[model samples]
Target: MSDRKRGSHRRVSTSPWKYVVATWFAGVLAAVGLGAVSPAGAALRSSLGLSTGELAWATSSITAVSAVLGIPAGWWIRRLGAHRALSWGLFVMSVATVAGATAGSWGMLLGSRIAEGVGYLLVFVAGPVVLTRVTRGGIRSAALALWGTCVPMGLAITAAAGGVLASRWTWNRWLALTALGPLIMAGVLTAVLPRLPRAPVQHPYRAVGAWKGALRLGAAYGSLSLVGVAVVMVLPLFLTERREVTPTAAGTLVALVCLGSAVGGLAASWLLRRGLALSSLVPLGALMPVACLPAFSAEFPLAVSGGAATLVLLVDGLLISAVFAAVPAAVSRAEDVDVANGILNQLGSVGMLMGPPVFGVAIAAAGWGAVAAATFVFGGLGTVLLLPGARTSGTGTAHGVARSLDAQDRVDVGEESEPLRKALDVSRPNRNRI
Candidate 1:
């Protein structure tokens, strides 16, 4: 290759890995900010004199805003470019986290969380889009799989730390301290990350049809969020109430379960490297939870039950990672990624909005078994919905291959016919004399 070409190639490859890491780091901070509330829910409740429902509102409010504003956020991200979107998102999250720290009333905290949700949506939408742009080929799949770990890792780190910290310090102080993380990350991203070019203006009407498949995948993916939110939000409470563990122990155990999800993400990456299809992975994800939930919810010895629960959550994490892997697989066009991610984020918000409260209600009405049953139902439905789409995806791939082959055959036939046609033309030139 020419020196100019080599230099250009080197320049393109230089910063992508850096960009991927920074973007993923920003995502982790956002996840930490989102999860900082879960383990501290009890502390916040007592400190602020909140009722059970009000406590749930602290977390669900974020999702509520996301669900409502998700689609619009996608359009906005497309307009703003990924770098700017992330910077703004991190800034908003920092502000909201501080607001939550200083909240004087339950209502104030809820409102702050609502705002934080909007910030989280911005980061969430832009993170993958930026990652997609920076990475290419096999690296993109692995990077995305690794990207799936951010949420669970953030949840685990914050929940584990929050439990220990909240035990020593006031919840407000804990919140205030953690608020610095996203603030710093936001500033760093604004200063260091290169800005992405704006996406071309697309007609909204034409884009809608293209988004339908992504929307379906997003909905199916969202259903798993319901399962995830239920597990993360309720597991601590379940352990405290049903398993007779201390609040701190319950929090620690919950953190362990969340950590399992990080491992699951890595495992999914390994699977992708081995050439497993996203469709096969999705059903495995759905069914593993169904099989494990019973063991997790059953009455066993503490050690045995804890181990079972961890296994269940580990599988759940793997499934969540697989769902993320499916996102890029579902959308064929590059431009559609942001919109599809937006739809996924929005539906995920809906699931997050509903999951915890619904689980709480179910647990109240029946018991942990009810929660288990609910998870099974959702998982099954998600599996059923996902299979048809997976089949369609597979069929589309086959048809695309067939079309390529048919086109190649036509080209080959045309080349062979060219010589024959030329010879015939030379022999039949007397026709011009007529």
Candidate 2:
């Protein structure tokens, strides 16, 4: 038992933050590689004279298909460990990306995107799981923020780099670079990642029972990421379409959100050290909607409005990063770290999958301003939902007290189930004394 405890402690290290960074950057590379290989699908479609439906399918498959791959990827990582799985996944992904860059037909490009989807799921799922298993507290929060910010940050960098290279070089040059990032990432990850000692699979995923809570978390994450998606996708259009800003300038403005997000990551890591409750993130989450208000009411000069938007956007970015940082801790406070992490990630995946569509429909029915308002409404509702349950005696305490009560209740959650163990142990703060 003592040996097992030592092994478990070893599994959950305070070091190995580098491995966390590498694995997450690998996820970022996957996102960048996919984007680089097929950045201008609409233009490519018009050049090919493809139908609207075909173009939509091609454009949507990148993330939608990737989202569906998360479940199996999670299970696979538990069995194979992160290194071997990520190495092979990244290799295959790189190959597919290069293939897409070379494709002469839309069908081939679509196939490559679909293949990349598989690789994306494998890498993204494994990276976070590895981070949680390997770190605790501030390091863990920092690691997660690093991983979370990388997607937007990578996309911004890749998109800009692709545009700059495309002015003089072919698109394939940028795609090649993007593809190369993952291959290099795989090697770096393998070298730096500590060997994950094999352990018996003890915990299994359970269905989330708290729909009220799940919906709140989902809506909050989804709304924020949705606005982010809309901004990333449509900001350039907004600048060029409505404001007559130069494409380069517009692109720069759009990319600033990602820069803000990266900065926000550092803020979140700092917040963790301040000993803030995870639920406090709800207010930050609420700020996302408020941030959008300025974009609508820009009565000042372009520079002024843009700068104002950017500053508000910094807070928006901070909120998004903070929430992502906080949710895992919230789950840790509420349940088992691994199990709650899995469920939270699964819900995040679901939210991410759902976000784009919600924004798309709102964009069609109303407009960008309306979509922003919708984002605000969703976020507000989410904040309200995260408020601690009023009658909740079984929530928000340390792991041991919940365990005792669960044992008394005869739930028989079993020793192997880490989530059950954790959930039972974390007692409600309301009733927990000493």
Residue 411, candidate 2: alpha-carbon lDDT: 41
Candidate 1 local lDDT, 33-107, one digit each (tens): 887886677888888999988987786676687788887888889888877899899899889989999998998
Output the lDDT of residue 212, model 1. Answer: 69
lDDT of 1: 0.71
Best by TM-score: 1
lDDT for each candidate structure: 0.71, 0.57
State in Å the error of residue 244, model 1.
2.4
Instruction: Give candidate 1 misplaced runs (Cα > 4 Å).
Output: 1-15, 286-290, 360-367, 388-434
